[model samples]
Target: MRSTSLLVLVGSGLLLLAGCAPATGDASAGTGEAAAAAALAEGEASAAAPSPEPTAGDAEQWCADADVSARVDAALASDTEGPHNGVLVSPEEMAELGEPEAAIADQRRAWEALTDDEVAFQQCLRVRQGQSPVDPVPGSGS
Candidate 1:
């Protein structure tokens, strides 16, 4: 999907360039053959180019990135403002349920575990919004 979107973006740019190409006084004066040859050369160059190799740690990261994105999507789908649905609470009620420090601490740890993937996914979202894609969040490994 990401690749498809990028292709569309690039295709759009190419179309804009084609539209902006200068029109010769006599466009058919060898221009057509020259353009055809140029396109052929470009196609041959593209065909001969070597494909990119994934980095060393990419094998391990592939699954982690997908899993973290799935988890985050699920969490967001079920997002809520917590059980305390915005009602005034008395000082006594507040004191009754101190701060749930342990729960907060555990949640923080869980978030930390996924922070890098989360940042990378956020950049993916930015690209889907028509912004430039960014580098994946820096991980300890790479």
Candidate 2:
């Protein structure tokens, strides 16, 4: 059972790291998430006074394409393993993938598929990623 669990984890991790085939589109194609991303990024610089908190939903919209990629890569590194963890695709590679927006759509779908436990785990990750602490998950003391 443990081995199977590990395999599933490893497989999922690999999928995230895998680069999608190149597509022909504008760099900003479907990325309409700058405002929210700015809020999130500003959260780091303005820890003293968080004016507009970035909602957990649609992190892409809250940040620029580069920042969105960095956030996802950071989350991946914190949760996964291997030397390649947290390593983002090169700018060239991202261009091939049709800009940063390409990954956002796929990432949103994957986020929706997360289980309860996974969601909690990611919440903890958010805390580590400089997001403010939200209410504790029910039944998860502290």
Candidate 3:
């Protein structure tokens, strides 16, 4: 009976050690494959992300042109007294004004020459007129 009990204890100890042994080579390979898959997924997500739009840097370059400036200034000045005061212009209106045949030829020409940032600014202005496709302007950074 004593010998049988000692044999059972020894057998159980060996079983536990075998179960706890370090993972073999294939274990790391499985982990590597999982990491590779995750990296690929991340790559795909980044590729699908949209590129950032252009920014306004040279206001003078686009808006400073006499022909364009006149239209932009007129558009800006026209809403000076309204609730639209301090707003830029709408994308739709900007698109219309950009057309050469539009009644507001000057405004269109100016809008056409605007940088993406300027265009974005104009969009913000249009928001004040309740023409924005998104929420109202967020609080000022200041």
Q: Please name the candidate that would achieve the greatest TM-score relative to the true structure.
A: 2
Model 1 ranges off by over 4 Å = 1-6, 10-48, 69-142
RMSD in angstroms, all models?
A: 23.2, 16.6, 30.2
TM-score of each: 0.21, 0.28, 0.24
State each model's CA lDDT, in order: 0.29, 0.33, 0.30
Kindly report which residue stretches of model 2 are placed more than 4 angstroms away from their true locations once superposed.
1-99, 132-142
Whole-model lDDT, model 2: 0.33
Q: Local error of candidate 2 at 46, Å? A: 13
Structure candidate 3, residue pairs in collision: 87-125, 88-125, 89-122, 97-108, 98-108
C-alpha lDDT of residue 129 in model 2? 38
Model 3's alpha-carbon lDDT is 0.30
Per-residue lDDT tens digits for candidate 2, residues 1-142, read: 0100010112332122211211122111112233543333233233433313335552433233454455445644453333233222222222333335655344444555656545444443333233432333323443
Instruction: Name the 10 consecutive residues with the lowest summed lDDT in model 2.
Output: 1-10
